[model samples]
Target: MLSYSRVILSLFAAVLLAASCSDPTGAIIPDDHSLGWGLALADAVRDSEFPAGVLFMVSCIDVNDEGDPETAIPWQFYYAEVSDSTNVLIVMVQYIGTTNHIWEDSTSIPLGALPDYADAGPWVTAARDSLGSAYSDWEEYALVVKGNEYPEFPVVLNVAVLQFMSPDTTEQLSVILDSDNDNVLGIIQY
Candidate 1:
């Protein structure tokens, strides 16, 4: 027979053990799909006094066919732009298991604010058009290929050239984030 003190101690140990078994990384939490980055971006654009805007997102779910994230890695990239060339925003979200956290950062900068870079306009345009038509919603462009040179996605052979047309002027620009083979692509207009 166990003494009362020993039984109490055992219960305390069991509680501690259960707490230790809880998820440390919080990745298992389902995406609530609440009002997050997209809505915030629209508000930001409005505050900046911009006319219309467009939001582009590319995500690579690092899950195997079994839908187990533990078996793979995850990557997400986002881009938002106003009708004018004045403001462009970017966000990147990555999962780092070693730290047991999801890492993310965002910034908004003007198009000409960055230094000069190579013009892959033609390549990107051809690639985007090759998909037939640009849909206003996110769509999967490719599937994850295991043991390939570009495991995250395929090499981006085509680039997307987005054009924001307003009554006054038409702003055309190429966003640099690209996913080759295994990336999901989609655009949201506001």
Candidate 2:
């Protein structure tokens, strides 16, 4: 003996529940493109805010090269790893808006080509060759964190920022941070 309003409310609840169950996060974010190279042992120890054995990999993707000031968009990609003796938790910061953010695991993305570590000279030369003078500012960093860092639990944060593009779109990059411990090693463990 339910009223008309009660029946309608029940149906609405069931529909909402079904939708959430299908895709818990509401919308799915696209996978990032991985960089073939990971954190070097030397660089890890040098740059890591974490403990002795954390590894990190990072790269920028789908970059827009327009230099005009009026229609530029800026974005950053970040990776954070939290580990202990028993478990490891890794989070990928794909895109962050003014209030909300999206993140996933490190493995979900596919790998890109490896950067040449042996000779840093050639890599810079190649980037310059491709980019030319159309860019007002183009700087590349090696094993640096552009965002926040927490030394406790030996947390490791690796970040890259892509700035100034023609159409306003978010930028993405792949980064891995691992505790040098064998168990927590990322895809491209050093």
Candidate 3:
């Protein structure tokens, strides 16, 4: 079980991510969606904030798919999109300053913030809901592979963990792509 304080943070993150993933039309969560960084955090444990770090948003579109600019996840990473365009907003937040847990693969900064990352683009949220609510409620983040940089490096058939990291914990939303075909996965935090 999680402590009272931990639960509150987790819930807040869940709601934030949920809102981020969705748009004016709605967000989609697949059963086999790739379990990204944030998704796992909400899935396995409860943290007031995630371990500060950087998460990569990767995506590709299916030409004949449904919805405006509908697409499928590539075999590499996933991203949160407010619209069809590549424009996405990765909300950078840090609730605490120090943490014992650090991403093993990445070097940790000595100071500044708990979770930190950057985007190659600017962020723009709904200023005001001219069409009802100025909020997009996305339930899950989408994992899509754009490309495999090393094509000639002996491509081995393996399961690639294309996902977004919370810089804290790997928790919910969903996992659409999987090792096996014909299925997608989704998760929720309460």
lDDT of 3 by residue, 1-190 (tens): 4698899999999988888876544544432222233234321221332332223332322111111112333222222221222322233111111112222232221111111112101111111111123123332223332222223322322111122224343543322222222122222232
Per-residue lDDT tens digits for candidate 2, residues 1-190, read 4798899999999988878655455544322211211123223332343343232333333332221111121222223342322221222223321111233444332122222222222333333343457433333223322322324324533222222232323332222232121122121211
What TM-score does candidate 2 reach? 0.22
Pairwise TM-score winner, candidates 2 and 3: 2
Q: Model 2, stretches more than 4 Å misplaced?
A: 1-38, 42-57, 60-106, 111-116, 119-121, 137-190
- Give the root-mean-square deviation of each candidate in angstroms: 16.1, 16.0, 19.6
State every prediction's TM-score relative to the real structure.
Answer: 0.25, 0.22, 0.17
Q: Extract clashing residue pairs from model 2.
A: 53-179, 53-180, 54-178, 54-180, 55-178, 56-176
Please give the TM-score that candidate 3 achieves against the real structure.
Answer: 0.17
Please identify which of the two predictions, 1 or 2, would achieve the higher TM-score against the true structure. Answer: 1
Model 1 regions lying over 4 Å from their true place: 1-54, 61-70, 84-190
Better of 1 and 3 by TM-score: 1
Candidate 1 per-residue C-alpha lDDT over 1-190 given as tens digits, one digit per residue, 9 for 90 to 100: 4698899999999977876765665444333221133234334543344334343333333222222222234433233353344443433222332211121243332211111122222323433454344422223222121112223435443322232223333422222233333232433233
lDDT comparing candidate 2 with the true structure: 0.30
